[model samples]
Target: MDSDKDSRFIPVNDTCNMLEMTLSFPEQLEEAYQIAEKQELIKINHIPSSIATIGMGGSGICGNIVATSAIENIKMPVFSFRDYTVPEYIDDKCLVFAISYSGNTIETLTSLKALLDRSLRNIIIISSGGILEQVSQKFNLPHIKIPAGRPPRASLGYLLIPIIVSLGKLGLFNRYEDTIKEVIKEVEALRTDVNADIPVENNIAKDVAIQIKGKLPIVYGTGEAMGVVAERWAGQFQENAKVLTFNRTFPELCHNQAIGWEDASGITDKCVVISLEGEWEKGAKVEQRGALLDIVKGKGIPVLHINITGDGGLPAIIRAIYLGDFISIYLSALNNVDPCSIGGINSVKERIAPYIDKLNLLS
Candidate 1:
């Protein structure tokens, strides 16, 4: 029962059906935007000298997304913090966005408290009601409550849109609405193009799924927005497809990771390189990648170069992301696994639950 021949690879299976969640991205995105747009954002008079986002796992990605776009949108420094310790750059002049889908991520929660201990006056909590939200309510911090049902990873749109909208409030970017609509259109188009209804031979996502079946995915992207998408792709593959991935960004990889690809350990046979390239790629970046691409190809490696084009801006990033999502689901089917269930993650959570705390002091 080869999936390519039968075309069952795209069909939803038991244990998890992520298709509906994928389709609901537009709605989730709109909801997130409305939440941010309506909120009476605090500290409107004083813009932070720097911005630090605190979270781990799926929720943490929101910060990374903000950081990626913030660097390009604002002159101020912005970055995400994943550890229990808050970065030293965060002070009263810093804005901290604490994100946690479940609202109870120990690391993010700890990081939030650490920031508060520093007397950081500006902090916002985005969550679906966990310890994070509870503490936010108690501490009188600005909080955005998002709809919850799907896993944190599947809540990308719901989580990410607010950040974009908030940036709009800060005058960092003025194109949230248009960019969101464009992203919705592009994702819908991507859905139609890569859905199970489309035959494998004609589907780009399916083709990549087939090629990378049972092999490790090595995702490469440039330093800009595309790099963030590549990280999301790797995480989706890990959580949805139940596969491991290696990641590298261009320019940086050329210095060390490029030469490491030299077939000393048969990596060429077991891995597929998925390069995420943006249309706005500059000549210097393109030239640097050319040499790296040559080295990988010279070793007889398979490469999937995805060229993201159009004026969609943020939407272009989502389009590429949606493609990778479809590929993850298809890969799950090919692997005969449930795209919806993350048993390994659950097991670890249960293992750590014994030491989980009440955080009564926060309340």
Candidate 2:
């Protein structure tokens, strides 16, 4: 049942429609797979020794996942670039995915220009359409087009799956559709549990929102496993809930950030700590996170932990990410903010129109 149809506390979501998109993540993944299958990518006879993806914000997340996943799965070099220029190590021999949810992102365009100037032709574009599409047509480069309209963050499947399929096409990834199907199942299950229509008592996300209300959220996760997911949670909290959020991973925080918490005269009460749970090294009984929990609780601060429910695969990662997304949305409703509105970003773009408004992303 769509929350929009229910009159009980979801009227705000009815107007925004983000709740629908959030709940439809499984369908989005299916749509991405279908679209990727239909895409006609240019043939690359030899798989490049390295891969890099350039993007920012929502589009950049695809690259982050690729870079992180590649570290564990791929022997070759892979990187996700958020800046205007590619690293010196990336040359014509390296394959690049120029991703921008709105194809007009000036940074990505500028980076693409730099690549072209370097005569680097091994690049593919993933976007809905804008200056990127123009560049794609002008250069006759292959491009993948996804649906536009909703927020870029909500279109995770559109931005992510093409990259996955392209890698499979290049023989870099072995399980393409199967991996996607598994995640879709997990997300489907997650949606039912976290839906806005679900009551607060049974909904973990709703429970989280209630607990962290009127407090800053500081999320900590295992560095290698959930760093990107932590960042995702922070970004969602910032954009959807219109709140300041912080994210850090383990060990590194143990050495420095934990000490700062010792003298929490003014900071401890204002913040709620959420430690995203994941597997730790074998025989490491007292994980740094376990120690940090005692440290925070000793200061009389609130600390909570959440873990993924599925097998530790892409499904687990996506499940955790989806949970955070709902928490942010539910928190948005709690704070009376519109989840779909991005006034800060829009104001900046509007204010800088003369210098940065050359391309129409919707076109």
Candidate 3:
């Protein structure tokens, strides 16, 4: 079906129109920033000793991005978790952002309740509406409400921008509002090249999708900034492309994963490496990335290196994500799957609903 060049096949393959959502990402970022800017700045009397963001799956990923982007910028430690339990070390002095797009994710609710139980007042809730909004109202907790109905994965801008802008307003991060403005412009330009209307002859995203379409995709992030992006790319491939994908950070993977590649030529043939190389990465990590790609190529595996392009930490991360997102959607077209159909996840959710009801942790 020449998924990259044939426009007719796109509609047939992507019945749910995930391409439209991907196209709107640039706009989403702008709108998200405006929404966040309009909110009254979060007021915390004291500088938090640390910051933690908690959630699972799509919603949880924003926390990872926040922590990673803040690594070199913020003085306080930042942590992100996808588990039901909050880390014991996160005392009342820690600021917590509890994210749940649906506001009913059992794990998030449980963890938020845990924080409340421990008398943690430095809590901010972000959700579209649901149990989370209700809980916020019940407890008089600060809540940032986002527009509802979009899939949590598709709401990355709305999910992430509020946290960044709020923290920036409180002097925790610098140049964030400006950085976001640049990101919007970069992504808007990027979207033109990656969007569905662009053909394989000109679209890097489509070309990359064709290269890795049938192979297992393993995303490697060159550093902390790209590492979170690597995770997001893998997730997009899973949900949008309906494929099993994995992600690992550079030097760390060089130590252990490289060893597996040495003796696994047979399996290597079925895989493609998509390395998210950050321009901001240290030369040492860049060298490691090149070496790692060479090792994979020696074993006859295909390698696709995506250079992340943007002005700074957050901007670069967003640009990479925007490109990867389009690539994932194109890959979905090749796979002939509806990108929005998450039947497996929905089935699991159905099975677990009763158990969550029984627990009644929110009450």
Local distance difference test values of all predictions, in order:
0.78, 0.81, 0.83
Question: Which pairs of residues clash in candidate 2, taking residues 3 or more apart in a chain or in different chains?
Answer: none
Off by over 4 Å in 1: 1-6, 354-363
Clashes of 3: 0
Range of the 10 consecutive residues with the lowest summed lDDT in candidate 2: 2-11
lDDT of 3: 0.83
Question: Distance from true position, residue 127, model 2, in Å?
Answer: 0.8
**lDDT order of candidates, best first?**
3, 2, 1
How far in Å is the alpha carbon of 206 misplaced in model 1? 1.1
Error at 178, model 2, angstroms: 1.0
Q: Write the residue-wise lDDT of candidate 3 on 242-343 in tens digits.
A: 989999998899999888888974687689988887666667878887888898999888888787765447778888888888888888878888888898
Model 2 per-residue lDDT tens digits across residues 268-297: 779999888865423342377788889998
Model 2's lDDT to the true fold? 0.81
After superposition, which runs of candidate 3 have C-alpha atoms over 4 Å from their true positions?
Answer: 1-4, 8-15, 359-362
> Per-prediction TM-score, please?
0.92, 0.92, 0.94
Alpha-carbon RMSD to native, per candidate: 2.5, 3.1, 2.2
